[model samples]
Target chain A: MVKLRARCLLLGDAAVGKSALCHMFHSDGTLFQKNYSMTTGVGLLMKCVNVPETNDSVELYIIDSAGKETLVEACEKMWGQPSLLCLVFDLTSEQSFASCSHWMERVHAHCEGLHVPGVLVGNKSDLSARREVQGSVAQEWAESQGLEYHETSAKEMENCDAPLLGLARAFHSLYQERRETIQNLSPG
Target chain B: MIDSSLTSLGAKVVVATSSDENHPPENIIDGNTTTFWMSTGMFPQEFIICFAEPTMISAVTVDSFNVKHLKIEKNTSQNASNFAFVGEKELEHTDGHIQTNAVSLNGSSATHLRFIITSGYDHFVSVHRVSVQN
Candidate 1:
C-alpha cells in the first residue's frame, strides 16, 4: 500500500469556522466547540485519509492559523511551503468571502510561485437564513482561482470530510501523472 | 537517459522498516544522494515502494552506506503482498563513501517493489537513493 504525507494550510478571516472545521474533521465529527476561543498562534492537526477504492492513504498535516489581521502576520511565518490549501470563508459574511483573494496571494508568496492544489470552502452552511455569499458566485470565483468549491457546515458536521478527501485524491493523481511521464521514458 | 529514470519521473517509498523524523523513507526516492534514510539499528530491514501503476522495470541502482547484502522482490497486485524474487546483490562496503550498485530485474512488470536488507556492514545502515530503469 502507498502512504503519503502533505501539508494542508487552512486560510480564512477570523470567525469563519476555520478551527471549527479543522477540529470537527480531526475528531471525526464527534466534537464541535460551543464556546469560542481566539487562536493566537498556529494550531496543527493531523488526520489520515484513505482514498476510496485504493490501498493508498494520505496523512494530511492541517495547519490552522489565527485569522485576526493582527495575528495573520505572525501566522504567515509558520505556514511553510504548503502542498495543499483549504481556503475557508464565512457564508454569512461578504467581507470574509471577499478577502479570499488576499489570503490566496499570501499563500502564493509563501509557496514561492508554485501552484498548490486546494479547495475553497464556504463554511457555516447551517446558517442559511444569514447567508450573504451566493453559491454561484463562490463557484465562479473558485473556478477562476483553479480551486474546487465545497460548501460545509462545521457546526452540524455536514460535508466536513469532502474537502480534505478531495485534497487526498488530488495528491494521489499528481503522483500518478508523474509516474506516467516516467513510463513514457524508453529504456536506455 | 535511463539512468535512475524511475524516481526522476516520480515514484515514492511508501513503507520502510526504519524511518527517522528528520530522514524519512520518502527521501530515498527524492533523487538526492546527500539525504538518506537510516535504519534504527537491526538486521532484516525492509521497505516497499509503490508505483503509480504496474510498471515494466528492467533494472534498479541502489546508493547506500554500510550495506552488505540486498534482496529485491516485486508484485503486480494493488496490494503489497505476493512478491516474487527479482534478484539479489552482495554489496561491498565503502569506507565513509557511498556504495553504488545496480541490479537487473529481467524486465518484470510490478506495481510494488520490496527491498530487504538481511545484513549490513554496520548496526545502522543508510540508503541514499534508488533509481529504476524500465
Candidate 2:
C-alpha cells in the first residue's frame, strides 16, 4: 500500500467558501453556513483519502488560512510542505477573482525551485446567474499558467472530487517517471 | 442618513453600531473582529478612526496601552493600527478612566490628531458617538 501526505492550501478573500469547501471535502460530508468567524490565523484539518488505482492511502492536511496580512507569512511557513495548491476564488465577485493573482504570486514565491501542481478553482459554481467570471476567461488564465482549472460547487459537491483525483493521478505519473529515470541510471 | 454637524478640523464623524454581537467572526490567529461599516455622510475628508482595546491599564500596560485605531478613506481599505497606545501624558490625565474619555474626534483642523487617555478603562472603543468641531 502506498502512503502519501499532501497539504492543500485554500487562498482567497474573506467569505469565499474556503472553510466551507474544507468541511464538504472532509469525511463528514456535512454543510455549514453558520458564518464561521473569518480565519484570523491558519485553520487546519486532516483527512485520509483512499486511492483505489494505486491502492494508496493518502493523508491530506488542509489549511484554510485567514485572508489578512499574515497570509504571506503563513504561506512562507507552509511553503515546502504543500504538494498541491488550490487557489480558490468566488464566482459571484470579480474582485475576488482578481485577488487570486496575489495568492498565486505568493505561492510561487514560497514554492521556489519546486514545480508543485496547482488548480484554479472557481467556487460557488452553484450560483451561476450571479457569477461575474466566465469559465473561458478562467480557463484561458489557467492555460497560460499551464495549470488545470475547475469550477466547483462545494455546496453541491459538483466537480469537487475532480481536482483531488487528478492530483492523485499526477503524483502517480511523476513517481513512475522518477522510478524509470532511477532505473536508467542503475548499473544493472 | 447624513449628519448636519460640520467641524473645522474633520468632517462630521461617522459612527455605526454592530448589527449583533451574537455572531462575531474569527480570523486566522483566532483573533476576533467585529465588522462595522458606516454609510458615507457629510464628513471632512480625513481619517475616520475606529479602535477596539481593553478598558484598563492594570499590570499589563508598561510602555503603551493597547489601542486599536484605523484611518479610513472613502472607497479605500482602512489602515489599521493594532496594539497601539495613547500618549503617556494622555493616559496620565485619563488615569485609565477611558470610559469617560468622550471618545471624541477633534472639532477643528490639524495635521496629526492623537487621542490621549489619562486613566481608568472602558474595555471597548466602539464606533458609538460621532461629532465634529468648528
Candidate 3:
C-alpha cells in the first residue's frame, strides 16, 4: 500500500463558491451552510482518498483560499508548495469563468516550472437556467491548460467530490510514473 | 515497476539531525508529501531510514524544498554506522514547490539508508518524502 499526500490549492475569483465546495467535499455533504462570511485567509482541510483496485491512497491537504486578489496575495505565503490544483468558477457567471486564466497564472508564477496536477471546477451547476459558461467551452479550455474538468453544485451537494478525487487520482498516477522510472533504473 | 512504496513494507526513520513538533523525521517515510520533515535552520542535516529487513534498492526519489546538495549512504550492518557512500546529487532549486529528484543507487542491499544534506538553497530545508525502488 502506498499512501501519498498532496497539497491541493483551491483557487478562483471571489464568490465562486470555493469555500462551499471545499466544505461540502470535506464534510462529505453534511456541512453545507446557508451563509459563509467572506474568507480572508487560507482554510485547510484534509481528506484521504483510496484508489480503486489498488491499496494506494492519497491524502489531499486542501487549502481553501480567499478568492479576492488582495486576500490571495496575503494567503500565498501560507499555501506552501501545492502539488495539486483545483481551480473553481461559478458556472452562472461568465466573468468568474474568465478569471480562471488569471488564477492559473498566479499558480504558475508562484510554483515556477513545477507541474501541478489540476482540475477546472465549474461550481453551482444546479443553476442551469442562469449558466453563462457552456460545458463544452469550459471543457475545451481545461483541456488546453492540461487540466481535467468537473461540474458540481455545493448547494445541492452534487458531484462535489469529483474535483478533489480527480486531483488525488492524478497525483497518485504521477507518483506511479515516477516509481516506474525508478524501478526501471536497470541496476545502474 | 513496484506498485507499492516502502512504507507498506514497514520502513522507519531511526535517526535525524533535527526535529520539530509539526515536522518530524518520520514524515519522510510516510509516503505523503504534504507532511514533511523540516530542518530547524542550518546546513548538514541528515537522517537514517531503517527498513524492516535488508532490501535491495536500485534508485530513490526524494521530494524536498530548498535542499541544494545531498549525499546518500547505505549499510547492511545491524547498526547505523559504517555506511558506504552510494551516490550524491546536487538538486535544483524550486520556488514554493518540492524539488523531486531520483538518484540511482546501483542495486545496493541495505538495512539502513542515510541521507546527508550538505547545503541548502535557503536557511531552512524540508524533506517531504522519499520513495525507494527495489
Q: Write the per-residue lDDT of candidate 3 for residues A1-188, one digit (tens) a residue.
A: 55666678999988889899888987988777789778899899888888777776777888999998888889988877667899999999999999999989889885646677899999999999999999999999999999999999999999887887788788877766543333232211
Instruction: Write the residue-wise lDDT of candidate 2 on A19-137 in tens digits.
Output: 77777777455564556676667778776666656665556667777766555575457444455676788889899888988887877775534566767888999998898999999
Docking class of 2: incorrect
TM-score of every prediction relative to native: 0.62, 0.53, 0.65
Best by DockQ: 3
Provide the global lDDT of candidate 2 against the true structure.
Answer: 0.49
DockQ of 1: 0.04
Return the number of clashes found in candidate 1.
Answer: 0
Per residue, candidate 1 scores C-alpha lDDT tens digits across A133-172 of 9999999999999899999998898999999888888776
Residues B11-102 of candidate 2: C-alpha lDDT, one tens digit per residue: 22233221212212111011111221111111111222232221121111112121232332221123333323322323322222221122
**Regions of model 3 farther than 4 Å from truth:** A186-188, B1-134
**lDDT of all predictions, in order shown?**
0.83, 0.49, 0.83
Which tens-of-lDDT digit does each residue in B1-134 have in candidate 3?
A: 34465577898899998755556788888877777776643347899999999999999999887788999999998998999999999999775456889999999899999999997764357787899988
Q: Where does model 1 exceed 4 Å of error? A: A185-188, B1-134
Q: Residue A153's C-alpha lDDT in candidate 2? A: 86
Looking at model 2 chain B, which ten-residue stretch has the lowest summed lDDT? B24-33
